[model samples]
Target: MQSLSYVFPVLIMLAIGGYYVWMMQKRGQAIQNIGPAMHAFFARTGFRYDHMPPEPIEAHVHLAMQEANNWAPGNRETRYVRMYQGLPINHRQAYLYDDAGMSMSCNWSAPLPGPPRIPFHVADRSLASLGKAMREAFSNTTRCWSAKHPHAVQTGIPQIDGRFLVFGRDPNAVRWLFQQNPQLVGALLQCVEVDLWVDDRDAVFADPMQKNMNAAMGGMTGQMALGFDVAKRMELSIPVHDRMSDLLLMSVRAACQ
Candidate 1:
């Protein structure tokens, strides 16, 4: 009976050890899935890979987790990377691709969507989402796209779209701002191609570094970096649509910084 009593404790210890091993391995795999997403996003934003901190910013990661359940992960058009790094010092900020082809500033947050006037709140979540996305996209710029009325459409012709609006750095600055954000240039023309490709795979984009790298390569590779390497010059313009193409480029410039 004494021997059996010792055996029972041994068995319990063995079970605990096995469970720990299994959990550790699973966590390792989860970390793997997020890597390519990071590489794609930040890489596209022109962040030097050398700048990759030992860990993600803690606050950014926390904010990301708060919105982790959000409907739209990040504007699909921006191909932004979402990461929360610890960096040893633990300064956290959500890393995202602004609609411009550049990195979102460290203090960036998706703004709250509310009408500029009282009693004129946004109704359709889709329009509100678009406005919040544009706020992220054009934070550093002078012009931004927002709904003019609760009845406006964000896409199509802004004027005819009633509630939809446009983003600008002022009349003279549009072209100059357009020159800054390259991803917006792609959003205007190539987003459909990207969307089609992303849809074909049904994979979620979680990393910015790898996304940029794959996109810079012509999107030949899967979101997870399966078995391909796209050429570095993957840029292509979408079909022109009533000057909408230029507007797309403008978004890229705004986001690119």
Candidate 2:
């Protein structure tokens, strides 16, 4: 009976390990299938597509994500480029790794005509769950105590102020930019689950994968959750191109003004 008990547990572990490997292979295959569709779509739209970013674009991307100490760039599988409203925009999937794990971040960036300016960052507050909120609160407190964090900029508008966590080198400039461009605030609100940053050379918009209970679940639930994640990743990889382009154009225009 003791031998039976030991054998059952070993069998179960083996089954679980086999299931995990199978799911991973399936996910990889699904991701591979995505490339052809992406290429075809970009080709039809007259946007240039590349498996890897050109050197200049890669450098700009690295600089943009460098300020956030938690994130380091990973595989940037899809790079799409096109000119709109007299500005060239680069849209790509940037995989970023942190202490927890890697996440695929959908990133869009466009250069400004003028010289470099102080950088600012925006994050959607509405997306945070209780645990994430608590973690961020603790992190913020630590940063404040250390006197190493930039203060958050509040634009008096309740909707904007409540929904976003904004940080910048100059609070007055950040507030003034939002005040002058109500349209920009409106455009920003339309972007769900997205984060924004305006760096010295370019304005960037990204939607990084958020860790959730689904990612932490186990057994059948975990398998189901991972399947959903694969589907979600595919959806984000090839979002509505026109809508994204318009959002990028409007948001950048408002930010520049």
Candidate 3:
């Protein structure tokens, strides 16, 4: 009887775990169902998106560590796209919206060189306001900066104005990207933002949470979806994919001048 009791508990545990895994798989399918529409959306933007299932962590980590120079190697098995032929930076695992310029990919690997970092969602005034507060808090303790460029204000996209809040060990390279590529910056501002992982390296783990977080961030959008807070991960449609491609083309051409 005792052996049977033990066996029953084990069975229950297995059932529970299996059920949880099944639920998660269903949710993943629901998200991917929107892929065709997302592809079409990107197509309208004059960019090509090749949907690439997330690569193994070892591959991404090796790439990030060796060749990527400073880019974070994202999570394993988190589906994303490789975007190219249009963006200034050809990105792997870029979301459908605007190539790597504004993907909210959350497939980041931890144990990354420290000093927590939060990616600026869109470069605009609201984020700048947040940056000022952050700068005061960080106070030269780190190499982080909330970069605000006057050219952004001239863009006339109020949302794109002072949106410069960076938190990390060093954001100089990030700053350089913006300064050197004004059009890419413009495209980023127009795309939706997502939550970026910013926590102590030792605390993070490789697990389903990483994929879930990426999926959640991938599905969210809007100004409120700045990824600063968990509760703000709002459900949004991919309207910008259709709306911003032409504008980005025009802006990119103008900026080149």
Candidate 1 structure, TM-score to reference: 0.24
Q: Across residues 52-147, which tens digit of lDDT does each residue of candidate 1 receive?
A: 434454433333333423435553222122222211111113435655654432111111122211111111233345565776577743222243
Listed in order, each prediction's TM-score against the native is 0.24, 0.55, 0.32
Which tens-of-lDDT digit does each residue in 1-257 have in candidate 3?
88999999999999999999987675455344334434443343323322323554334334323322332454322232322234321222332333333223322222223332322222324333656578757863222223322122133333333453333223453344345556555555544441222233311111122233334356444333443321223122223222233333333332232
Runs in model 2 deviating more than 4 A are 1-40, 50-76, 94-103, 116-119, 126-130, 133-149, 210-239
Identify the superior model by TM-score, candidate 1 or candidate 2: 2
Q: Stretches of candidate 1 above 4 Å error?
A: 1-20, 28-45, 49-125, 129-186, 189-249, 252-257
- lDDT-wise, the better of 1 and 3 is 3
In candidate 1, position 111 carries an lDDT of 17
lDDT of 2 by residue, 93-121 (tens): 65556676655655677877764344567
What global local distance difference test value does model 2 have? 0.59
The lDDT values for all models are 0.32, 0.59, 0.36
